[model samples]
Target chain A: MMQEIILGDYDLIPDTIPSEGELHLRVKPIDMVTYWRRCGAVANFIANFYRNPQDEIYHLNENLISTTFNELIENAAKYSTKRDSDIDISLKLYNTILKMEVENICSQKHMEAFQKSMEKIIDSDNDELDNFYLNKIEAKHAGDKDSGIGLLMLKKDYSLQLSAKITPIEGEVYRVSVHAYYNMSVE
Target chain B: MELKAGESILKYNSADQTVTIEGSMRLANLMEYDKVSVFLNDAATQASDKLTLDMTKLNFLNSSGITTLSMFILATKKRQNPKLNILGTALFAWQEKSLKNFNKLWNEVEISIQ
Candidate 1:
């Protein structure tokens, strides 16, 4: 049986990043104006963190770190309440697996749009998923679509396992947390 | 042609037909990325023979960023297709995987990894 989404306490991350196996970062009440800038900085930090400690993971894939980290943060911010809400992001490495989590506040309208996209991902097989991504790219390139392609690439290109939870915190306000896992050894 | 957005720099050298992308590019969405492809596609059509994109220092690229490159590659099927070349580094895992996808999308695209 498939486990349900976890909407419990999502604030268990410590204040600082660990030396060898974990890293965490948080920026609350962010606005769209500065969202891209912030995600770039944190992605570089996480990518370098695992890459610098070469003893922990041989030949660290910094691009993987950057791609995965940025994609999640960007999506979180897009749906986020921008100016007045918190957006939390974290990364942890254990036994050749790197896990990333992002929690951000979003609106009911954004929640519905995002959930529809996620359903396509969860329902498709590898082949179906690939076609869906390519079609999205083509449509977007031709100026006919605005569907975000980050999460699709997260799974197809990076082989990440993605799971998300959207829960209402108040009227018209919701909290969305997406957890992604990347198996470094498999690649 | 050159596009400088904060730390990111996208320089297209018309004389040498090269597009060099350095720093991180995390644009707002695919729409933003389409502008990049439009710029590249325009450059490709004007190229007399060939075009090269150097991503050696481009450490971060969201899917939208890579999608822009793929769109550029697919554009080669057009009548005025220029011989496309991509130069990237292998140390960056994203480049290592993402760069190869270009050839898979359009096999004739020339790629060099250092």
Candidate 2:
């Protein structure tokens, strides 16, 4: 599969897939913006991998795709400043939903706060998310830039199932992955 | 304008009566403009009663930027202190499209497209 969509230095095209039907993207920070600009490259690669005989196309809304992926890269750039720190985006189709996961190397302390923010955003309903967004804005007045609202906005806007996991890499490097499930079955 | 530097490249522009912000406000670091937010708290500030924003260079703004811009406009109306004039100059065709797309969410704000 590697030979099919050979991975490039900056981006990996649909290049072949693994036996488990997972598509991997070896993404760089600079290519992150272009990666987002070309929406559905992730989901499309997955759909092709799973090869659903139904010939399904995951038509992710432009706005939703742009917002979620932008957040992913923004966080990647925010955290991955150290050597060999890069963002890894993986796509897996579990059931009817397409799972989009973005992992980056960041400070361990920031991971705890990032996880807490994800949990709060995942648990929040529309009204709760709205209130949280507004409260964060108000907090800005007190010199508190609650960056968590970016995660909350994803929850409020797309209403996707979101989560994060922290993994320790070689040489004491840390990895934080944020995942969001998009329902490809939606009409 | 009150320009406060964010962690790195991010800058928050508050009310400053003297300086003038020309051209489009582009959050050059990230493709998503939403990461940038504008806050207008006090009723009596040096900022424009009716502010004119030049979107000549603003390519794309994310949800956060949109929400923040909306709040700035809301604050302008709620306080009713001065007319918050929102204006944009589209440098590229896409800029015009973005302003049009975002303009819908900002019905409450008095905005003009140039």
Candidate 3:
């Protein structure tokens, strides 16, 4: 069976951005887990690549972009079922709006869990999201590992529109593509 | 006591009852943040009157790090002894936004952003 789900603002993810304003990075999940620092390094590189010295908000946007990208990369690396497979990350700039997409292979179990979290975020109002985030933090258990706080924090902290597309691959594995749109003009 | 990993540094000064976290922290997962959680929890326990967390120099922190901090805050709230005071700088946009969310966790938490 093949399935696809779009959470929010799926139409905003364009087919392309100008060559000068687009960047793509590919990394294996194994390297991300073994060398944890690679996540920050990749994020910083992409942030720097998009920074414009002429813009007065360069420093602020640089930090914000890096933090956003870092979370996406970390989540992709953590949930991926095939450690040796490549996770593709693409960043595009359309005027003041920045679009980021990350695609990775995950087991059916992981994809289902990810979809549930994304759905909650897209469905909640501002107050509900805040309460949900706080409850998750307070309900932390010793054995319960996945907090799903990264995506929640992004939803709560930034003016980012989030969505994901899941495509069935084989028996229980699937390819999940997560998309995020951030409007720098608002900041 | 201090924990230095990658580009970040976490330090505790018993004399001043302050834990200064500098640089960026992007630890992989919850397990990787255990040491930092322990450090902050220890600092929380040792402070009798007030515990201050200075994050002015911390330019970046991933969600895992934020969760660790939130857990530390909740534990301190449960103890209800050492009042928690977090010192952040408005220079970092995240501090202006995310740090305030700590207040919702514990309203009594005093957050001062300079």
TM-score winner among the candidates?
3
Deviation (Å) of A11 in candidate 3: 1.9
DockQ of each candidate, alpha-carbon based = 0.61, 0.13, 0.75
The collision pairs in model 2 are A5-A15, A5-A16, B34-B62, B34-B65, B49-B83, B50-B83, B50-B85, B51-B85
In model 2, the runs with Cα more than 4 Å from the true position are: A1-23, A29-58, A81-83, A93-96, A146-148, A170-173, B1-59, B81-114
Candidate that scores best on lDDT = 3
Point out where model 1 deviates above 4 Å.
Answer: A1-22, A29-32, A50-59, B30-35
User: First chain of model 2: TM-score?
Assistant: 0.66
Ranking by TM-score: 3, 1, 2
lDDT by residue for model 3 over A148-171, one digit each (tens)? Answer: 688888888886788888888899
User: Candidate 1, after superposition: displacement of residue A181 in Å?
Assistant: 0.9
Per-residue CA lDDT of candidate 2, range B25-60, in tens?
323232243333332333225455544454434434
Q: Candidate 2: lDDT of B30?
A: 22
Fnat per model, in the order shown: 0.72, 0.12, 0.74
Give candidates' CA RMSD values in order.
4.4, 10.5, 1.8
User: Ten residues in a row with the worst lDDT in model 1 chain A?
Assistant: A1-10
